[model samples]
Target: MARYNHPEWHPLFAGYASGPTPLTTGSYGQLLYVTEFDGAPKIISEYFPEILEPAPPMLWSHAQGAEINGIGNPNEVRALTAPTFGEHLDDWNEIKISSS
Candidate 1:
């Protein structure tokens, strides 16, 4: 049996309840499989956090833009409270993709 691996995915199980940590002072992209926001399941969305020093972090800045497949760009919020999301809060798992 061959083991398949998916690189380019740094899975973090920080459900919508506690929510993920905000990038205090940096810019990066994140892809989340959020099962929160409205009681629906498996809501995939992308986030780009751009925060610089000196300026205080703002929720609106964190949710500047998101691209959710199937559901055209929906309004984004800094956080979402969902009971379902609280059920699964796992640790970080880093798996890099490689060309075999």
Candidate 2:
């Protein structure tokens, strides 16, 4: 499973090696921090039963910005808040990423 067409979340911009489930298809709209640990990290825009409702409104991505541009995040900003990790994930947890 290797897909990366994230031109502004195009086609759900997914590159999961072995993670995202719950009918991980994607092709509607939003979906930020998607984790499959059966826990937190969820900014949905519909990822249930294959995209449904409307939970879209979580942006802020300058390719993981923060280096001279931190004024309320200015690169597709709109992410009020919903990203936390200090220990909490276990259920198919084997996070690995590479795009080079």
Candidate 3:
């Protein structure tokens, strides 16, 4: 039930936890992705009713860039393409960050 305040995507920066859901069933962050191409971010994760906030209209996030930075993703510059296993992820921004 911990929350990390991501500077770039505050408020909408979904939480990542042991499982999929965040703190509880109703207090979880949704898997969201963003690319600067069209300036329109896309919801990569399946629609979760318990999601904290519905993806906002015209909402832009640096999630993609964050992932690219964290993982050394080669496809960081492109929206449609993701590096390797990233293609399988529901949320391109979803990363297994080390709990350091």
Clashing pairs counted in every model:
2, 0, 0
Residue 85, candidate 2: alpha-carbon lDDT: 21
For model 2 the TM-score comes to 0.16
Ranking by lDDT: 3, 1, 2
Measured by TM-score, the strongest candidate is 1
lDDT of 2 by residue, 1-100 (tens): 2223343533222221212344322222232333222443333222211223222222223333212121221122221222222111111122211222
lDDT (tens digit, per residue) of candidate 1 on 7-72 = 221221222223345532122233344433455444344343332322122111234233333322
Off by over 4 Å in 3: 1-25, 44-100
2 against 3, candidate with superior lDDT: 3
Candidate 2 lDDT (Cα, 0 to 1): 0.25
Which of the two, 1 or 2, has more lDDT?
1
The 0-to-1 C-alpha lDDT of every candidate, in the order given, reads: 0.26, 0.25, 0.30
